[model samples]
Target: MKNASRRQVLQGAIASAIIIGFNPAMRSWVTSASAASEFESLPPLDGILYTDSATRNAAADDFGHLVRRYPSAVLKPGSVEDIVRIVRFARSHKLKVAARGQAHSTYGQPLIEAGIVIDMSSLDTIHTMNAEGAEVDAGVLWSQLLLASLERQLTPPVLTDYIELSVGGTLAVGGIGGRSHRYGVQVDNVLSLQVVTGAGNLETCSRSQNRDLFEAVLAGLGQCGIIVRATVRLIPSAQNSRVFLLFYNDLAALTHDQRWLIAQKRFDYVEGQVVPDASGGWRYMLEAASFYTPPDEPDNSSLLAGLSYTQGTQQIEDKSYFDFANRLAPTVAFLKESGVWFYPHPWLDLFVPATAVDRFVGEIVSDLTLADTGQGPVLLYPVPTDRLRLPLFRVPDEAVVFLFAILRTAPPDASAIAKMLADNRTFFERNRDTGGYRYPIDAVPFSQADWRQHFYPVWGRLVSAKRRYDPDNLLTPSQGIF
Candidate 1:
C-alpha cells in the first residue's frame, strides 16, 4: 500500500512539473485560442479545445512507427458543423487544414505545421443501407462496417491492406488491396459522399448529383473538401475464399504470371509482395484468394512447374472473405503497438502499363536487385484495368502495377534498414533515366516540373480540378503542387 501510494504521488508530481514547465507558453496558446473563440461562439466548446503543452505535443505524431514528426494543430471537431466551421475559420485565418484520419501514414503526409488538422475520429456514425447506398460517417472504421455487412451477408467489394485503417482514412488516399485487382479501387466503389466544400457548403455529391464535386473528391487526398460522410457501393460477401501463397525466385517471372492472371481474369483476387531472402535480398510473394480452386489437383509436380517458384507448398487456407481481407490486422496492430510506425517511410507507388512493365522491371531489378525494407511485405500488385480503361484518371496507360518499398528503421546494427533507404534513393535517381514516375513519393528529390511531366496529359485535368476546387491552395500546403 505504501509503495503504490508513493508511485501515485510521483506520477502526480511529474504531471504537475510538466504543466509548470510549460505554464508560460501554455498561457499564450490558451490566450490565442480564447481570443479566436471570442470573435464568435464556436459550438458548445464544452468538449475541451486542447491547445496547451499536451495538446500542442499531439501535433507532431503519427502511426508510421518510425518517421520524423512534423508539427501541426490537432483539432478534434466534435460535430459536422464543427468541421465546416473550422475549415472556414482556417481559410479566414490563412491557416491550411489537413483532414487527419487515424494518422496511419508512414510518410509526412499527415504532418503540416502552422496549420489546422481536422481529426475525423469524432465524426463516427454508421448510417443504414438505402437507395443511394450505405451512409457511413467518414470517421467510422472499416472493421465495424465489415461486421455489420457480414450479418446481412453483404460486404463492400473493396478494402485496404489492413482493415484497422479508417474507411475514409484509406479512401482519402487510394485504398489498394488484393481484391482491387478484381473489383476496383476503394474510391471506385464509392457511390456518393457528403462533403464540406472549401466554400463551407455541406453538399451530398455523386455521379448523378454535384458531378464535378464528386469527381474532384475521389482520390482527392482531403484537398477540395472535408468528407464528413460517404455512401459506398455494396456486394454480397463470399462464404469462403481459397487463399494460396505461392513463392517465386524471379521478380520478372512472378510479375509475368500475375500480369497474365490479372489480364485474363483467371482469379478473383491477385496480388504479390517481395520478401527478403536468406541474405536479406527480396523474393516474390505471389498470393491469390479465389472463390474456387485451380483446376489442377494438389500434386507436388504440378506445383513444381510454377514459374521460377519453389518455396511454398501447395497450401490452401479456406477463410471467409472478411477474414481474408483483414488478415494483416494482427500484424498491423503489433507494428503500431511496438512503436515501429515512427520511422520514415518512403513508399514509391507507380501505375505502369502492361507493355512498359517488362522493361520497367527489367531495368529496375537488373540495376539494383531487391531493396531491403525491414518492414512489412514489399507489395507488387496488378490493379484492375476496367475502371480506368478510359482516360478518366491520369496515370501510365495499360494495367496498373502498384509498387511499394517501405524503409523501416531498426537498431543500429541492422544493415537491412540502411540498404532499403540507399536502394530507394538509387531507384528514385535511376527512375528519371528509366522513365519511372514516383507519384506519392514526390517529396524525396523529384521537383514539381518532373511531377507535371510524370502526370503527362492528365496534368491539365489535375491542375484544372485544383483550380476549380481550391484556387487559393489553402488545403494540404505540403503537396506543393498548387
Candidate 2:
C-alpha cells in the first residue's frame, strides 16, 4: 500500500544528501543562530517564561508522553504584541519556535528540547463572541469559550471532544469529535485567523484575505505560522441534548452501521469508541444524539437501514448543552489527578481505505485485544468521504473511510516508556505496509522520507506549502519538518 520503511528509507538517501541549492554564506549564519538564546538579553514580552520541568510537564498536552522534548524555555505570551516580538527575535536568529496550545499532541512533537516555546496559553483574551461569530486569543481554552458563549446564548458551530483544548491549538490540526460528522471540523468553523509567520510578519487570514495562509494553517499543525488569534463561526446554542449509547459485540456490524449513518446524514453528532471486554476483545460504544426534539424520544429510528437502533436499550440522560460537551470531563480529570496522564502515549491512528476496512480490522483485532496497552481506549468510527456530505475535512478523494486509533498513556518509568516506544514502532510498521495512514498534529516517529510516501499523491502539495510559508524553516522545528 505505502512505499518505503525504516530500512528502505535509504533509497532516497542520496538525493536527500545533496542539498541541490543553497547560498553558502546565508546557510552558515543560519546554522550559527539556529539555537539563539539571546532572548535572555532581549526586552520582556507580555507573558512569563516557564523552564521548570514539573511546571512544563503539568501542561494538559497530547504529547506529554514524549519524554525527550523538555524545552529550555517556555514563554507564556500575554499579548499578541508579545508573540510578534518573540517571532521577530527568533526569525532574526533562526531559532525554533513552537506554539503550544493544549499540547494534546501525543508525541513530544509540540515540545522542543533546548528551544523556545511560545505558550499561547497565556493570551486568554476573548476578543469577541456573538451569534454571527467569535474571536479569541491563542491561549483561550474551549471550555472557557463555551461558557462565555452560553452567557450570550450563543455557541461555536463546531467543537472538539476536549473543550479544555485551546482554539488555536485544535484549529491548527483540523479538530474533530462527535460533532464533526455534521459541522465538519473545528477548522471548518473558523472564519478568520491572526497569524505571526515564521519570518515575524503578522497577518490576518481568511477566505477573502490571505486565503493561502488560511488554508495551510487549517489543520496545518503549526507548521506555517503561529496562530495568535482566530475568529470562530457560531450558532445559537442548542437548548437541550439527549445522549444515548448503542453497544455492539461485533466490529463488522459496528462499522457497517456507523458508515451507513455517516452517509445517510441522520444525526447531529455520531461516533464510536471501544473498551476492553472481559473476554479480552472489545465492546464498541456508539451514540447518536441531538437537541432538535425532547430527550425521551428515541434518537435511533432507522438512521441506518439494517441495524436496530437499540436491541432495545433504555433511555439515558438528556443533558444540558454544556454537560454534553463535557461528558468525558470527570473521567479525564480523574486520570489526570492520578498521574495516569503523565504516561507517554504510544498511539496509532489511521484512515483505513474504504475497500480494505474489513480486512484491516480482521487482521489486527487479536493483537489489540492481547496487547498490554496502558490506560485509554481504542477509538474506531467509519466516516463519510462524499465531498458534499462532510465539508469540513480534507480527504484525498470521495472514498468511505474508517477513523481508527489506539490511544494509551505511558508510565513515567523509562523502561515502560521504552516499551511503549517499541510498540509504536511495531504498530507503524504494520500500518505503513497497508498504504493506509495519515497524521494531524500528532507524534510522528515516521521519518521524513516515509512521511512523504504516507501523503502519497498529496505529498508534492504538502511539501510545496511547507516550503512557501516556512522557507527558512523556523516554525515548529520540533515537528522535524526540515
Candidate 3:
C-alpha cells in the first residue's frame, strides 16, 4: 500500500512538471519506472531540463567532430543555483554529470553517455570590471571579455590565439598564447574562482583561500569541480601593435632566433610556424609583435638588430590592438565557409624539452607530407618552464620547452581518421620517452594507466581531492582521469 502511494506521488510530480514547461520529449527516459521514480523527487529548477532530440544532438559533438556522446537530458541552467540543485539531484540518483562550455575540446572531454549535461553557456554574464580585472561567468567567451576590456583601454595579459573559446573552458585546460613568454598562461593570471564541487557545494577559492581546490580546479580537466565564475587579471592595453613576419630556411636558425628573442625580451609577442613551401617542402616563419602608443612607436631596426632571419624576406604590418588580438577571426571564417571546419581534427600538441625539440620535430616533419598534415598549420614555439605555475599543467623538466602542435584536419573517411590517430599515438610515445607531456587539448587516446602516468607525483593529491570534493565520482567521467 505504501509503495502504491509513492508511485502516485511520483506520477503526480511528472504530470505537474509537464504542465509547468518540462520538455515533453523527456518521456523517452522517464518511461522507465526506476528513472521516473528518481526524477520525480528532483528539486525545483530555475532552468529547463531539455530532452528534445535537437538539443541532445547539438550537445553530442564538439569542435573536433571526432567523438559524440548524447546525454539523456541537457540542463540549460538559468542560474548558478540551478547547477547546484541539479548536481545534488544527480549525486543522489548516481547520475554522471559534465559541464559543457563552447564544446571546443578536440576529444569528448565534456561528454557523458546517458547522463546530465549542464549547458553552461546559458550563464553568460560579465558581472563586474575595473582597472584590476573582470569577474565573469564561466560561459563568457574570451573574445567577449577582450572587447569589454578594450573599452577601458585594458586587456588580459594572456589570451589564446583563438579568442572564441570560453574563459572557463581555456582556464580548465591552461590557456597558452604567444605572450606566454612574459606573462605565463591564462590560469596563472587568474585571481580567484567560484566553483561548484561534485558534492553540490558552492565554494570560493584562490591562492590564499581553499588553496587546494584552487590549484586542482585550474587545469584540473573538470575532475574535482566545475568553474562557474572567475576573476582574471588585466593590464593596460596599447593603442597599436607592430607585427613582424620573418622567414627562415633552416629549422635550427628559427629555433635559435626564437630562443634569443624570448631571452632578450625583444618582442611583446612571439610565435613560429612551419609553413609548406612552393617547392613542396616546408619552411619556417617567425611572427613577433611589439605593442606601443602613438609617438612611442617600436623601433623596428632595433627590434630586428640581432636576429638571424632571412634579411630580404622580412615583412612588417601595423594593426590596432584589437585587430592584432583577433587576427585569426578571418581565417576561421574562411575555414567554416570552405567546410574544412566540420572535418575531423586530430590535433597533437606536445611540450618537448628544449634539449630534444630540434631532433624530435625534425624527425617528425622530415617524413610529414601534405596529406599527413591535412592542409593545416604546424605551430612550434618556445616557452620558459619557470613561468608555468600550476602543478596540473604539466611540462617537461627543463629551463624551456617548445609547444609543438600539429593541427591536422582529416577527411571524413574512417580510414583516414584511424591513420591520423595511430600516428598521434606513435608521436605521443616518442614524446613521452623524451620526457615531454601532452597539452591535453589534442585527440590522443589515453587509457586509465596512461592517465595515471600523466598525473604522476601529484596523482595521489589529485585522487585525494577527488575523493574529498567529488566523493561519488560523478563529475566529468568522460575525461577518464579518476
Candidate 4:
C-alpha cells in the first residue's frame, strides 16, 4: 500500500511537470517516473539528490557563461559510495551523467541536459600526505593541497596557473603551467587514481596496475570514468622564489629565448605573455622564476646571462613559494568585484608545434585588437613534447610545442559573443592545418570527426578503453568525443 501511494505521488508530479512544458529531454525523465518497475524509487544514496529548481539551475552553466544545459537532478555525494550507487542507477535508467568540479571549463564540457549531474565538491577531503606524495579527494582544490603540503615542506611537481581549480577537474584535462616545461603537466605527475567507471565499479589504477585504465583516466576528460580520488607525485619545496620579468619587442626574439631557457633548464619556471604596449602595439614579456632557500639566492646575472630580451627593461621580484603559486588570487577577486568575471569567455587554447609557433603567433597578434582580447591575458610559452607521456593528453608532433592561450572576454551582447565564437572557429581551423591541437578547455566547436582526428593514431586505444570501462556510453556525453 505504501509503494502504491508513492507511485501515485510521483505520477502526479510527472503530470504537473508535463503541463508546465518541460523540454523533451526533461519530459522523458519526468515520464520515466510513471514506469511501475523503474520509477518506484531511486536507489539509496549517502548524499542528497536535489530536484529543486534552485540547485538544478545552478548546475546549468559553467565558467564560460555561454552554454546552459539544465540537468534533471544534482547529486552532492556524501561518500564515494553515493557516486557508485547513482551511476549504477543512471546506467539502469539509460541516463547521461557528468561530474562537475569548479565548473571552470569555458565550454559545456561538464553540463548534461535532462540527466544526472554529480556535484563533486561535497567530497572535499585530503586523505593523506607523505614524502612520496599526497592522496586527495577529487573535490579538493589545488590551493588546499598546496597549503597542506607546505606544512611538510613538499609540493606537487606541477600546478596550474590558477590553483583554485579542483584536482579531479584539472587532472581530467592536462594541467599545464610555467613549471610544466620541466616536471610535465599535472597529469604526468599523478601516481595513481581511484575512479568509478561508467559501469559503477570502483577501481584503483596506476602504471603497474590497470595500466590501460590509468592512462585513459588521466587527461581523459571524464569520458570513461569519474575520478573520485588521486595520489599525485610531490617533491621538496623551496622556501622562496626569485622571479624575473624580461621584456622583448620582437616576437621571434621572445620565442627564441624561451626555447633556449627551457632547453638549458636555467629557471625552475618559464612562461611568456603578449601584452599591449602604450602605443597600442603588442610586446612580449618573458617571465621566469628560480627557487631558493634563505641562505642562497638566485644570481640574476648568471640566470639572465645569454637572454636576448631588451636591455634596461628588466624587472625582478621576490616572493615566498606559496605566494608565487597563488599569485592569481588577487586578480581573480578583482575580476569578480568589477563584474568582469561573469562575462562570457570564449577562450582559445592551442598547442602549436614549436617550429610554427613564431610565425603562427605573430600573425594572430598582428591582427588582434584590444576589444577582441578584452581584459584577459594572452599566454604563450613552450613545453617540451618529449616530457608529456600520457597517451590521451594530445600535443603537436614535435620536440617542443607552444601553449598559446587567448583568454578573451565578451560582453553580454549576442552579436559580440557570436563574433568571438566565429573567430575561434577560424583560429582553430588555421591551427589545425599547422599541426596544432586544441587544449579542449576553450569554447571552440568540435564534431565527432574532429575529435577522431585530434586523437589520430591513438584513437583506437581510446575507443577500446571506452568500450571496456564505459560499455553503455553513459559517461560524460557532453564532451561529444564518442
Winning model by lDDT: 4
Give the alpha carbon lDDT tens digit for every residue of 278-373 in model 2. 776766667776765344454445443466444764355677888888777998889879877666776766767666766776566656643446
Instruction: Order candidates by lDDT, high to low.
Output: 4, 3, 2, 1
- Model 1 lDDT-worst window of ten: 18-27
Give the poorly placed runs of model 4, Cα more than 4 Å off. Answer: 1-38
Better of 1 and 3 by lDDT: 3
- Report the number of clashing residue pairs per model: 13, 11, 0, 0
304: Cα error in model 1, Å: 11
RMSD to truth, every model? 6.7, 10.4, 5.7, 5.0
Q: Model 2: C-alpha RMSD to truth?
A: 10.4
Model 1 stretches with alpha carbons more than 4 Å out: 1-48, 65-72, 130-132, 278-281, 292-312, 336-338, 362-371, 389-394, 400-426, 429-435, 439-446
Candidate 1 displacement at residue 92 in angstroms: 1.7
**Cα lDDT tens digits for candidate 1, 314-420:** 46677767778778877767876986654445445555555566566556544444333445455677775665422233444444555444434444343554555
lDDT of 4 at 182: 96
User: How close to the true structure is residue 337 of candidate 4, measured as C-alpha lDDT?
Assistant: 100
Report residue 332 deviation for candidate 2 (angstroms). 1.5
TM-score of each: 0.81, 0.83, 0.93, 0.93
Superposed model 2: Cα runs more than 4 Å off: 1-41, 49-63, 293-306, 309-315, 386-398, 413-416
Q: How would you encode candidate 4's per-residue C-alpha lDDT over 160-271 as one tens digit per residue?
A: 9999999999999999999999999999999999999999999999999999999999999999899999999989999999999999999999999999999999999999
